[model samples]
Every structure is written in structure tokens, then in C-alpha cells.
Target: MRAFPAVAGNETLRNGLPGGLYSLLSHAEQYRLLCRRPDLIAPAVDELLRFWPPVVEFRRTATRDVVLAGKEIRGGDKVVVYHASANRDESVFPDPDRLDITRAPNDHVSFGFGAHFCVGARLARIQMSALIGRVVAELPGLELASDAPPKRLVSNFQNGLKELRIRWG
Candidate 1:
């Protein structure tokens, strides 16, 4: 880890691609992605979860009468926790509006918290990371294919870009 600082400080190495995987080696690399290096897999899935979280709103019913944030709730009353809102909570994240690649300790509740956590979380993370890694590697110099701006979805629940056209050599 100590070597990381010295390597990071070198400007020439900073901008260059390290040759672990290239677009040409994809067939073999892809097979390994399916079977090995699960550690790499988790972050990839987390990235997509950060990008497009599913199960937008989760509702929980109070076992008994309760009050939270000065709001009164009776037993069997359903309270919704909007994951999308919580994921972008400004109090928790600096510049919550931006997508940061290196944000650590990102305890976003996209997958729910505590006992309610998703069972497929591990699998989900692996698949997403592998998929994204492959796409980026294939399109190393990828860029927007169209000059036109994107058209966003009208629904509040979906955070998808309608179109993101791109082409690269």
C-alpha cells in the first residue's frame, strides 16, 4: 500500500491504462469474471445499485403506536422510507447530487438495512460490476455518439436516462 503513493504521484502512469485486461482478451476474461474474483464483483454491483436502485420505496408497518419526527403513528400504520431520497440524503453525503467513483463508506440503503437486507445482494453486485467492467473495456475510448441531449423519464421513481448514444474506436 505504501507503494501506491509513489505510483500515484507519477503523472505518466496516472493517465495510462494498466494492461491487465484489454478488449481483445474478453472471451477468456469474461469466463473468469463468471467464475472467479468475487471481490471485484461486489463493487461492480454496488456501482449499478448506486446508479439505478430498485425497490424505490419500502413500507414498514408499526407493531404498535409510535411517534417519529413529531408525527404520530398507530399500530398497523404503514410508513414508507423512500430509498431514492435516503440514497441522496444531503446530511449523509457531501455533494449528494454527484456520482462519485471513489466514495467510501457508502452505506446507502438501496438494498435496505438490518434484517431486511436483500438476500441476492452478493450476486447482484458481482453481475453488475462484471457487466460494467466488460462494457467499459470494450469501449475504451467511448464517447457520446450523438450531440443531442438526453430525454429523461417523466416518472419520479425511475432515475434512468432515456437515451445515451455513444460510439468509439
Candidate 2:
């Protein structure tokens, strides 16, 4: 139907799929950090979304004048919500910078909130869960192959890893 554009689906597959993979890899990395406590794997996924979300910024338009964190914006204002900043907000997440796998009540906004939430959120989580579970189950000794850090793309919209050099057990 012309109501829904073909380009939207194409972009979703191209971007969403990779974003899920990125979240999964980050979960794998967290396993290394909390190897002693293997039980932390599940929450690590949420932690990754909070620590390093798939995208940096999203856009929205305010329909009514309101104050967000004491800042007032009039109606019909275009807003650029930064996920990276909100995820690490100290007021909301204590010890925000420190990654805690056992963190409970993780109200992360990686998959937007309210009316603008992603429709494929559940599917994406399932994919990440399966991939992360598989990697942890099959490759227990996997490690980063290179000492050099991952090369992140210089983009304002998408948060992606240009290359993730790793070694399989």
C-alpha cells in the first residue's frame, strides 16, 4: 500500500538488524567483564543498550508546552532526544558511568518510549537474546583479537562498529 513506504522497511532491515547485532556483541563483551558471575549475561544486554545504544539521537515534536528537567519548551517545538545522554543520566541511573550487569529495574529508552516506541522492539530483543545466548553457549573462550579498539563510524545518527576484531575459542 502507498500508505506505507517501501523505503521504510528497507531502512529498518538495514539499520535495525545491525543495531541488534551490535547490542548482542556488547553483551558478549560484558560476559568477559563479569566472567566470574555468569548469571549476569541477561541484564548485560539491557546494560549495553544503556551504556552504548544503537543510535545516538532521535527526533520528536512537542504538541504542548512543558518543562523537561526544568527546561521549558513551547508547543510545536522539534526536539532532538539524545539517547546516549539520557541513558547515563545520574539523576535516573545511579553510578551511571559504571556498567552493572545486575542492575535491576533498568528503564532504558534504547527502543524509544511512549507513542514513538519501535514496533519491532520485541523482535529485536528476541534476536539479541538468541544470538547472545548462542555465543555464550558455543564460544566460552572467545576474546578480542586485537589490542586496538573497535573503529566506530563517525556518524551522528547511527552508532555502529566499523569492525569488531575478535578471536574464537
Candidate 3:
């Protein structure tokens, strides 16, 4: 119910939409630098999610006692998995801090892992792709209006933006 109207819903969009748009524009800048390659859109979205995932972290209760990284974890313990940090792990991604749209085998956990993965992952990607494609097509020279910085919302669960200043004609 919170996302029934993603853009129009103040309660939800206010906390997410701006940050999403900021990330989308970041991808747009990359596209422009790469000479606006049509083949890069989808890959860029994947990279963007890895680089600046909207959901910062999530928790899972250990179903059974386990050992990870040489540490013992008891059953029923709450484990806070920082998806954003995992996405940038150097072992999984070489030069993980850099945004390379062509980065394949991304294996990013932005959408969670295994059975916990988001059910809306595919749909969300499609929508984002369409929006990015449309923006590039309709506004070939879209840009930020000024040098003003993006306003961010400090959050524990989500990486959010309060507002993003932009201009395009």
C-alpha cells in the first residue's frame, strides 16, 4: 500500500524517489561520458544498484548455529547484513569502489540473497530501464540545474535523498 503511487505518495516517495532519481542521474552522467551507448543502459542499472543501492541493510535471524569468517554465530541470533557494503566487497568486485557499467558477474546483493531476494527485482529493473531509456531519448542533454549538492536523509535502513536539483529541456 505504501508504494501504490510511487511518485505521488508523499509518505513513501518523499523518502525514496529523490535518492532514486539522484542515482539515475548519476548513471545518466556515466552514459554521457561513454558517448551515450545504447548497449550500456541495462548494465548501468545493475552497476548503479551495486554502487548506490537504495536499501542499505536488512536483518536475518540465524536458523542454525554457524561459523562465518572464523566467528561463531549462535542460532536465533540477529545478523545485520549490510547489503550496500557487501555489494562493494573487494573480493567480489575488483576496484569495487569504482563504477564500471561493464562490470559483469556483478553478483551484487542489493536485492538480498537466496530466498530473501526481493520479489519485485525484475519488475523494478524493467521500470528503471524504461525510464532511463526514455530520458536519454527525450532529453538528450539533461543536466543538473546548478552545482548545488543533493540533500540527503541520514538513515539506518535506507539511503535516501531529501531533494535533488535538476534541469532539462
**TM-score on alpha carbons, each prediction:** 0.62, 0.80, 0.82
lDDT of 3 by residue, 21-108 (tens): 5665666657574336767777866777788777778778999999998999999999999977898899899999887878898898
| Residue-wise C-alpha lDDT for candidate 1, range 32-79, written one tens digit per residue | 453344444344344335434554566798889988879999999988
In angstroms, the error of model 3 at 162 is 1.5
Report residue 63 deviation for candidate 1 (angstroms): 2.5
Better of 1 and 2 by lDDT: 2
Which window of ten consecutive residues has the lowest lDDT sum in model 3?
4-13
Task: State the number of backbone clashes in model 3.
Answer: 0
| Model 3 TM-score (2 dp) | 0.82
Q: CA lDDT of each candidate?
A: 0.51, 0.68, 0.71
**Candidate 3 all-Cα RMSD:** 4.1
Which pairs clash (backbone N, Cα, C closer than 3 Å) in model 2? none
Q: Candidate 3 clashing pairs?
A: none
Q: How many residue pairs clash in model 1? A: 3
Which parts of model 2 have CA positions greater than 4 angstroms off? 1-29, 33-40
